[model samples]
Target chain A: MINIKKLALLIVFIWPSVLLAETMEVTLLYVGPTDSQAWAGSQQGLDEANLQGQFLGQNYQIKSVTMKELQDLPASNMTAILVDASKKNVLSLAQDAKYSQVPIFNLTSTDDALRSACVPNLFNILPSDQMDKDAIAQWQAKNPDIAVKAQAWHEDFVKFAASQLNKRFKRNHNVNMTDDAWAGWASVKMISDTVARTESIKSTSLLEHLKNDLSFDGQKGDTATFRETGQLRQIVLLVNDKNEIVAEAPLRGVKNGLDSLGKTTCQ
Target chain B: MKFKSLLLSTLIMASTAAMAEPSHRVFISNEKSDSVSVIDMKTNAVIKTINVGERPRGIGLSPDGDKLYIAVSEENAIAVVDLKTLQLEKKLDAGDDPETFDVAPNGYIYLSNEDDAQASVIDPKSGKVIETIPVGIEPEGVAVSPDGSLVLVTSESTNMVHVIDTAKHKVVKNILVAARPRGLAFNSDGSLAYSTSEVGNEVTVIDTKSLSIIKKASIDLKNSKPMDIKVSPDGKTLYVTTGRGNSVAVLDADTLEMKANVPVGKRVWGLGMSKDGSTLYTADGVSSTVSVVDTKTNKAIKTIEVGQFPWGVAVDD
Candidate 1:
């Protein structure tokens, strides 16, 4: 005979699905042209998330919004928000009373001041300007003999676009994917990972996962996480003119551990 | 009813007889070579190399000791190897990018899906997924309590250990540990668990019932990248393989103090012990060898060369 308590437990677990039917909605707020590279990159993440959702048994629907139209939408309907705008503008949106409860992902702006502002709802998937600069500074301090230089991508590589991100973007859209485009892709990927883990797009659980429980895979060894300061702690890659990774930071003794790059502790 | 009881007793005796037979052998999974190196226990020599599949990371015997389950990371499956013939038996879906797994006493395998950020429970006999419990990011290490009532999965990126209720298939508690928590082992009685965080350069001991970290232990070895940990059958000593430190640091279980660091091969990652608890083995990834350490003398007695990137080790007899 089946145990009564076991039967009761089974019924309780199964009964929830019968009661609630909800779909998570992720909003992508872009200030620029909808057809731009950054928009395309963020969309790539949404597509990847959707593909992974098949295995995870979660549903995520994306809604793209322009800056002028964001005010018209109800903030309560948004499960999560991806913001691509200037630092000041993104911070304003993060602090906006209507969207204050939503988890906001900053994809474009890399301002150090934005990170210092420490808006609880704001999350930066891209490295802050301070983080990037600190990474290079730490590397230079470690290896003083080696010369470092930066230049725009050569026309050939841009035209050919042999990198995996570039190749995938080119194959999908018939154009090279720039850094801004990759930022959009990465931002969505982070959300997708969170959704896969939580199975909920609600801001509270998603934000908790992002801040504390994320071991997000940005395709670079799966050791990425968000800092308390709202910076995504990732290794800074020093790419050569040919797009080869010459060096990576959070270099030995530059900082400790794989979870971050610089100023790891946040308030 | 009498006949059924008689038959059950006969079957139990037969199984016990089979287990009593001496079958001393050590198996090491080589990640880069995509093979398992079989070592002769008495001679401390690798007798044969059986090619399994791509990127074999974690290896262990089933609870009954009849089969070996190897986590092939690249294939996203667990390659089941028959112990008697030491050949490939079957592959079971272990979710995408399976890093390691722990076999439960109830015939379920709790597998860590590294890329998927979840733990998938599969029944080896049925080859069906029972459930997938969402865990922290980059889940790497899994340990099921001996009683089979609890499951612990450590996420390297999230730097947390998720305690799962086996029957409920849900995370009951999330215990924050050191950074980059990689490998874990439960004591014989399941009262405590030891976890290693490579980047944090520390090992945390969690009390099972409380689901809280009671102690954090570290040895004074320079550049210590502690990876896999194992508890002796007596629960007196804790054996930790320090990855880059190239040594095995033996610690006193009661006090959580380091006793000795026995030198092993370069970048040692996996730890295993003999059934009698007399000897220990370390899977050295960088040097591609297995170092046999004598528990009595606390010294590495033999270094048996194995395949490339030797990852995990398991001994069965």
Candidate 2:
């Protein structure tokens, strides 16, 4: 009798989520090579997103597309697109009027000009060149004698569960997670996270929420959010040649918050 | 001579009373460093450091305050530490990947097994697993109700708080919360419970009796991804550690309104409070420091550097 009662409770608990699940058909378009680092990261993100989506009563599908096939994409039906293309292609894709409504996540490009473009539809996951330069400058300003450079992602970054992410990526793809991969993963994860939390699948609403409401924990110890420039304000790792993450941009003692790393106000 | 003797007697009595005062100490678990730093609360200084074990995260004191339970995650065990001697007593099996946990009034160590998606209730006296209750996936936070009737585990991936019936050892209800709810704290009377959501960027207030959400408030500060939560002893105020906000937020308990965000070290996560509820000790993970916040002033009074990646803090008064 006790087992029956417990079983009833379990059914009651599991039934509603399964029954009421909206079955939101969200397609996450990836405009990149399947063998690339960014695609591997994005693939892992999709897998994790599906896991999270199951609980949220949503389903996410990834469609690998090319530059030529961009026009063939179900622009109206798709929820979002993540790009791992060149700076020119990214800008052109964002500027294209056909997919203007679809939110585009630039997964690989780090051109400062892209951020300066301030395309409303485009959200750059990779920090701009200026953001990296500024981060390194901040660290260099403190230690004038030591020369440092900026990095987007490092496999050795143990904080904020980066090690777990790296391990999972390596296990899934048989390769170390790179900067592009982190960006790709960040894009999918951010979209899935926003959709799950806000329970909104509409492109415009997701874009608005992505711009204003969402705060992503990009496995970077702190809050990584989108700025007015449509670029993610994230910590840039000061990685040296031995591929060791020596320090972070917005270097602890010198600069203030994450905003110190990137352009906050649009010109 | 009589007057001088009387004066000496009074001095001795005062000294004895001072010594009798509850020895105020704060023990912080440094996960990456594999040690616990003991701080003398009166002076707020690191008086001693005990090498507990690898990946020590969750920490709590026994009901009698005689022992310390540290969740050594990598080893999948709880390190029993004799507080008096500041030494590790033994490691008790706590199931798989115990990250955070809470101590019940009944002196049972309730832990969250993240990897297994379960909460294991261990009897500290005998060092035995009394009951293992199933819960949601990636259960990160374990919070026991003030009355010890419920053991709540917040699962990160599942985004639900599974409330375990202490008496029957059954999962009574599953309460849905925001994304990545990592920490939880109940009011002084257990009438209400507060939880912090890391990715959702909100603090949810739940009616403990109803097992329903009362309110959800967005953290006001920029990059405010709240991690751990603590309610003042009086139950009128809440101290929430904002993860990426890089500060501690003070909120009105009833209104769930953000009152203040006090600046602290980078990536502050675990929180412990003094017996008087006048001070809060925050374990800053990134900077590897503890910020001692005076609740009255809503400010960080001192910063004490600890071992690498300080995770959880347990205070004994």
Candidate 3:
């Protein structure tokens, strides 16, 4: 009877920890072509998250759907979306009441007007047109009449494990990891990271967590913070004519360079 | 005249010996270049670059500081280099895809087998694997206790740190941390252990006696994904290398509070401290440079260019 009592006490201590390890299956919805690099990155990120989950009790999976398929889907399971479509389609999807609370990331479009619209749950992963203009304007302010060109990512960027990430993508897909692919990968990274940290999968909590406490390592050699305008503050890579990154802007000397790059607020 | 000539020769020998050698040296494992760049810590100069093996990553030194060990991943062996001659001494079997490793007090090499999801104990003298302990998948970080009674291995994919008892050669406890745990370090007394979660960007401090987590502190810096961590010899401060944050985050060891972020090279991966803990050497993986920081001021005073993709830094003082 004493031995039985000791075994009972052991179960009571071990049971709660086992219950806490219950798997959290986070399902992500990819909105792009099946063959696109953007979708590949999202898929890769889903795999990465699942790999992380295998050890710590979280299961991440991705599903690809068309614009039409997304409109009719219910928001009950709270599937997050990664959009790789035109401005009109992206805005339409963002405006849909069904996905209003859902975390939707705009992976490709760069329209400044879209940021001005300020969809609370819609994350603009890429830099906007106005951000580019401001980056050039800041550059020209210092040096007038200088030609300026910039991009979201450069293939040759070797820092921040970008080269490692690129090599992985290249080995898996047999192509260079494109900028859209980077945004797609970043979108999943941001969401899964929040899920892991917050330990919650609810759409409302995810949205609030992103709005109030949003600092993501988007593999750009710095923390990627989101603006109230729903735009990710990024360092625009200034490229030369040969399509190589020459420098970064907000320039090295710019104070609070990360915050200086893009619009801080809506309207 | 003969006695005077003998005195002159002794003076010349003493000066030449002083100029040829320094009191300390730093070794960096260049992963992509498959080489080890030897640097003179006193002068901050690249003294020699030795081609060790295919994809050398984790670099370490023997307990007595006689032989340098480089984990040549592709070769599935540890390249042993003679400290005096700076030559490849021998290669020891380290299981498959060995990365980060540590030395037990008994002079056994605790190697983390990443691909096989296990940790191997190798006898350095005989170059043989005497024991294998199954751990979590993708084990990357290996740290032995100061007493050599326990060794901990962090599994990157599993998000857990397995604490293995050296005497039993078995896992005694599995401590869960945040996502993608990468590095592990033990304090001087073996009373506490700290682990850095790469994806979660948090450091979990563990009380070694109870194996319970004392606290989990967020690095709290933008773009700071911590890779490797080291505690001061006095155990007052903890230095962590922020992967993309490009800085060495200094934290109060007692409170786990943020103290300073000393900016270093891009993608700083691994770090080491001098014996006295007055200086720190950080390997910036992507920029292919090492940043030497003065601990007194918490500032990087010099940056020395190393081989391509310097992954691990081992300082022998």
Task: List runs of model 1 lying over 4 Å from the truth.
Answer: A1-235, A249-267, B1-15, B18-22, B217-222
- Deviation in Å, model 1, residue B182 alpha carbon: 2.1
Clashing pairs in 2: none
| Clashing residue pairs, backbone N/CA/C < 3 A, model 3 | A223-B223
Write candidate 2's Cα lDDT for B1-317 as tens digits: 99999999999998775443345889899999999999998888999999888899999988777788899998999998887777889999999888989999988999998767688989988889989887765788889999999878897755677778899988877776766779998888999988888877889998988988989888888778789999888898999998768899999988888888899999899999886789999999999999999998899999999999999999888
Query: Of models 1 and 2, which has the larger lDDT?
Result: 2
C-alpha RMSD by candidate, in order? 8.3, 8.0, 8.2
lDDT of 3 by residue, B222-272 (tens): 878889999999888999999889999999998889999999999899998
Runs of candidate 3 with Cα error greater than 4 angstroms are A1-21, A136-148, B1-57, B72-77, B92-100, B106-141, B147-183, B196-204, B209-213, B216-228, B239-251, B257-271, B274-317
Candidate rank order under TM-score: 2, 3, 1
C-alpha local distance difference test of each model: 0.78, 0.85, 0.85
DockQ computed for model 3 against the true two-chain complex using alpha carbons: 0.08
